[model samples]
Target chain A: MPAAVDVGELVERARRGQPRAIARLLSLVEDGHPQLREIAAALTPHTGHARVIGLTGPPGVGKSTSTSMLVSALRRAGRRVGVLAVDPSSPFSGGALLGDRIRMTEHAVDAGVFIRSMATRGHLGGLSVATPQALRVLDGAGFDDVLIETVGVGQSEIDIVRLADTTVLLLAPGMGDGVQAAKAGVLEVADVFVVNKADRDGADATVRELRQAVAFGHREAGGPPWRQPIVRTVASRGEGAGDVLRALDEHAEWLADSGESRRRRAARAVGEIEAIALHRLRGELAGVGGGRLTELAERVVDRAVDPFTAADELLTNLHTT
Target chain B: MPAAVDVGELVERARRGQPRAIARLLSLVEDGHPQLREIAAALTPHTGHARVIGLTGPPGVGKSTSTSMLVSALRRAGRRVGVLAVDPSSPFSGGALLGDRIRMTEHAVDAGVFIRSMATRGHLGGLSVATPQALRVLDGAGFDDVLIETVGVGQSEIDIVRLADTTVLLLAPGMGDGVQAAKAGVLEVADVFVVNKADRDGADATVRELRQAVAFGHREAGGPPWRQPIVRTVASRGEGAGDVLRALDEHAEWLADSGESRRRRAARAVGEIEAIALHRLRGELAGVGGGRLTELAERVVDRAVDPFTAADELLTNLHTT
Candidate 1:
């Protein structure tokens, strides 16, 4: 595809809000192509401004409905939005899954919204590397808001959630991870908690439990001063998405007042810089990296040296060569 | 603590099979102390010989009992054993959780059996970096077998499982992730599938479903020729642990003949080398690292330059300095 398609032209079109151009750019990111560095350099100047929101929770808690509701609400507010619905659990990837497309059909021709689902299928540095780069693409392409929705099951989900400026955790009445996910320390990253399926049987119980958990968490807290708000929603009927949006606005205000917005972005940038640099360094030090890896690996098996010393030797060679 | 004790002498004691010394050595690794490189250098020669077993699955599936069962079985065969029960699911680490301590009380008096639980509490590099080093400590200390047990909820567990030569995935009758976990592609990492709580009503059904999944998985497979064996165990009563032990020996023998063991260890070494080199390189490039981070981060945020260019400049400074 690169033999014919000019990456520079793609970037130009993507910046002008061409959905196909933006999709191609994301495909390149997901593919972990050799041209990624060039793409990133071209896209950088226009980035660093999108309001990244992370929406995550365990499986089957109406994440898609809530995401769609938020999308509709954001569109009504007249903001250009981009969503990367990522399923890190699946080891395979081709492109946007049918489920993602179906849930998002209403906005297919809106021109104000863009949605993409990332599959890990042979992603070079895994989702951690691909996600930040994709976020860059969306942020650069003139989107005012970017939403990252994940199936919130693993450490990768945790890492992706931290990339956002604000996180909203969704729960249903009888899901497995009501307080369980919070206990795993994901609660610290959540700015708002939504008990979706609020019209269901145990909605009140779920909300009450979540409120108690939130209060208990803050009782001995030492980090931020903003108390998290728990909102009840029946996203299928679009009941309380407005309240969720209002909560996001209020939280954004708190972030600015506390100087946490600047701190979060700075920390996020450092993390991105660190991941990219380490990935590139790994490449340069490993025959260019792979072939050299074989020789070094053989030597270690032969007890010629340990991994630490071999890594030192690899670094030494890098410094000299 | 370092000024009060000699690392060299401690290494000597640990290598002599002193449990306290081994515990202290692991503490240093868990703390990501500055002495890790020296410790690795010292432990390298005596390492490379222990059989590593990874035991993992979802929570409440009797991992502790299985680990304890395996410990007794290995000791009965006259092999010194080590167990590192890692809880990556927990954000707080205060050493061994009381539940972990309680589960293995039977082996507490056996000098030949050692068990430790890892909490993530401020682990400098996380379990991925710490597990291999901790494995080295046990292996170098003359333990013939080292077992890594994890709650198996996330990506961290998958990484830890790969560090071992053989991985045993335990599943109960009606746990959250039965075939669902298999679908997420943890099926490939598994060498033996143990359906614990075999006396439960759904045991036969789970085994039958797992067999079908395994057969389906291998239909188009091109890697190792080993068909994964499914073993059923009521771990709480120590009923089927012997069968699991026999399965381990069979797998070990197969690994010896298949050359997969050599390849797996070499790959493991390559990963460890990559991690260490990146850690050291990131340190050098970032200003001794953190202070340099703040200045570069500000520039990226101010749009003075993008993160890619900033990372490149950081690398350039690293080479020149």
Candidate 2:
């Protein structure tokens, strides 16, 4: 049964870029509402147009400031933007400070811009099954760009990279030790590196180091390489914002020319579908208490059955259900 | 289909606490070798014994130093210990700089201690499906304790916390800002907090801040609370090592008393089983590339079907398979 408010009407209004309708649908996603299936089905045809951009970096690295500035740049270009700032909540505690929202206040009144912060509170890693669906909602709502900003350089940020058309890694100067600490982790996900705070003392050195690290990392990976561009920025001063956009445009063009866009999107779709299906299967398995799964796990613990065979047996039963 | 080395023989030797045999079995886990299922099944009876401890902090908080000191203390009590230092490698570039190994070499000649660094290369997060299996191997091999050290505050470390019986969150005096940066991410996993470098000026301040934060986090989470004890240590000098061990023992007793141990282990088992099963399902789907799965994804992308329905159809086919 759908909500008392006709889901059909909401979909139509959301498609026309009505903020209220989009907000309502996203809340549905967040709540895991029963009628989300209907909403997702309704959002189908208008999807896949927005270029999803993921922005991530270590904590205290100005990810929020950069995101806000980028939203301004996109708006200046006459593009409607939707931002999802994913916050990783304290593991012991289920609260998110969300202080980053303060930097984005400039975009609060602009209808052309939509910004929301999502705390990865209950989810093991941030970006639950709801995340991709949320992106689809923004995509379907005629947003030209969807920017995802995840807090910290952890697993959630990496997962976010898989869904983005381009991933921007933000860094700042004089964070030499910090750069050294996270460079290896960030190298894997960065499509474009932004050394923000270029007005700081060691900006040139930081940029140079990053370039070298990127080159070295690419070589080690041993792929036919597309070199990740390192762009310097003073996001506080709004300098180098246009260059970042230009670099994104170039990457977009490259993706189109190589047909990598289609392949990447296809792969992303497959991943999302697999994740959802697995989640459902897990739910099904969990529903049966003191059931076959527990017995099998105990047997595996006791060495009565190999994990693979136990897995096979579980899967066989899964098929019948 | 087993390796020529006679897996059964190795399992017996490892059970007898032959360090070399244990090392060989752990290598099998790391490689994801074909005989892993056999190894896992064989090791099941010997497990449920070793207390797995996870040691993690931000990059430069001296996790290795703290781990080494902890190992020293554990060995002094005549407890056999195994250390799995998880290295988070770049996703794009399959490389890990395992500098942490050098610090633990002081224990190289000590027969009761085993230290190995596992690099998470080509795996999205460093702690792969292999990690739990590796711990099981060490567990089965009669190690009284297995200390797992991860490099940074990321998703892999969080996953590691799931497998650990007690997770030690390491901090240092001058790491105030760094601690603040990672506090929320680390809060969920910390069972005991160790403020290393106690000789430094801000040691007491860091300890004070952590207690306050821990209390705050607990209040916010609103659970049956376990008070995480803060211990100060100058790990390099081996000062306060005994206190750290006391805190761990207290936590261990608390876990057993509360029956949280069983719940945690059961939860861990459920997680491992689910991960393995999901891996198999993803493999099954990938094997049928450009097949029904892709079609379903395309349908979902086109809004021809909701993701849930598409997922259901996929699961149905998976069941039949």
Candidate 3:
């Protein structure tokens, strides 16, 4: 086991914009370390600062490239940015994540940019459970913006990735992304739609289809509906990066002006607290009754006790600290 | 509000293989009824009698068609079959599920078959949580076989679908499925590989690539590792279904002989029990301290309390009955 460290001291260093401190905090969250509760307690007050931008789309849509381009643009705006590339691909293959990291090497040395690739492995509840805590670490560290770039082909995966201040759904030309996006049910959560690789064939067609879809889908209730703008970009050549950035800024403004920012942040906090509690309950239940869960499972298989009763027994007296 | 269901009476009817009773029980599980605990307790004693076979593949791979063919084949052998087509596709779009139901219309009227399409919505843990309970209902209803066919595009989604006694990973000709399946990290969970649409061009190539990939990947550590068999089938034409069934039976024998069946079932039971406990806890927490979770979330947003502390307060005295 790693030696115990002072979480308060780490948080203090992190608040001062120390890279090592932020990295350590993120590792703790990713590793599901025992000190997480303490880290959250220390970091919570300093959070609620970063503008979280989630970039998601189907595979081969250049999500990583778009994220890298955004990071460069955000740095140029003199903003400290953090990037968490949540890989939703096969856990057995690290090739995509490896390729993503290589593509992000240009910003690796820039102090204003912090880039990390997160694999969805061993984290029960998948990306949602781990990403929120990691996002908190960046928020607590005083980053001006945190970009969560994930492979967002799956519907449930897209819902999990919607825990962001501004979610930008990226699509590429001729990928047949409009119908694909509708099929993935991602059009509902996206605040901004980005059509990357705009120089490619059928870029206009993709954008036109997306525009039609946006107009067709019902917007969220109440306060003036901020129309989702579709931005065109060739992220590989760093073209239209400024346009994407402008859209993001405009969305962020709409968010604050319409009071959607407050609602989104609060909803995010609710999800975060609930997820943390669930994670803790799971840990506690696993170790309860001196290894009861496994024994209960055995009994359940033997027909000695029903699973519901077994679950009830496990849940009883699962006291919180 | 729906009338309170009679749990014991329903179980008795379900065990007698009454279609209406079985459908009602499945509806309860899908709806996350408050009487789920009662339903589970009533159903547990009759479970463990069915063979669960899961068919999963990427979109456009014809999982639903394969499932329909397998259902007809199983019915011919005098085994009652139940199919749960769990849709992980866009929640807003029911087109795929509708298409699947239409294809299974022949089996819909068969007294020996039960077919249902499950949307992965309103279920917090997505397909995994809702599916296990649904499987149990079928098992208790005296079905000799339960086949779960789902779109397994994402890696985490595949892990959730592995709650089967034998998992069949489907591939198609000329879809570049070999690399795509590997990329989805699906190669690890497959017990048998089925190359559907075998009459199409590149069928031999797909099969050859899958054989090579299977040979390269490490098997689960155990006695006499089962070499995953590749079965070719034209599901749409109802050809080669018997070959796939034979492969399934062979794998089932291997599983029982290797005692891996016991392990997988026990592991699946553990996950089921835990998911039930978590779902119940979430319900209780949402009402705890008279909506204290929302209040705590508001406080966290206002920087009045750290999330960890709020989570602790919400978890405190959350007594499970």
Q: Tell me the deviation in Å of residue A234 in model 2.
A: 2.9
TM-score of chain B of 1: 0.89
Ranking by DockQ: 2, 3, 1
What DockQ values do the models have? 0.37, 0.43, 0.43
TM-score of each: 0.86, 0.88, 0.88
Chain B TM-score, candidate 2? 0.86
Q: Write the per-residue lDDT of candidate 1 for residues A1-321, one digit (tens) a residue.
A: 555457789999998999999999998877877688788878887887789999877545677788889999999999899988774422112222335446568888899999887764356677777889999999999998899987554556678788999999888887542235334556667889999999999899988977877886743134458888999999999999899999999988887888888888998888888877777787787645566666787787666777778787778878786
Q: For every candidate, how close is chain A to the native chain A in TM-score?
A: 0.86, 0.85, 0.88
DockQ agreement of candidate 3 with the native complex:
0.43
Tens digits of per-residue lDDT for model 2, B1-321: 645567789989998878899989988876767777777877877788999998877655667678888999999899999988673422111233446346667899988888776655544213547788889889988999998876445555577667889988888777533675556567767889988888889988888878788877653133255889898898889999999999999989888877787767766776677677767666665664438888987776655776778777886676665
Ranked candidates (lDDT, high to low): 3, 1, 2
Q: For residues A115-188, write the lDDT of model 2, one tens digit per residue.
A: 76565555421354868888988998999999987644555457667788888888888753356545655677
Which one wins by DockQ: 1 or 2?
A: 2
Question: Per-chain TM-score of chain B, candidate 3?
Answer: 0.89
Model 1 lDDT per residue over B1-321, tens place: 454447789889987888899999998877777777788878877788899999877545667677888898899999999988774432112322335456678888999988877754356666667788888899888899999876554555677788889989888786533235334546668899999999998888988878887887753134458889999998889899789999999999888888888888987888777777777787686655567667888888777777778778777767777
**lDDT (CA) per prediction:** 0.77, 0.74, 0.77
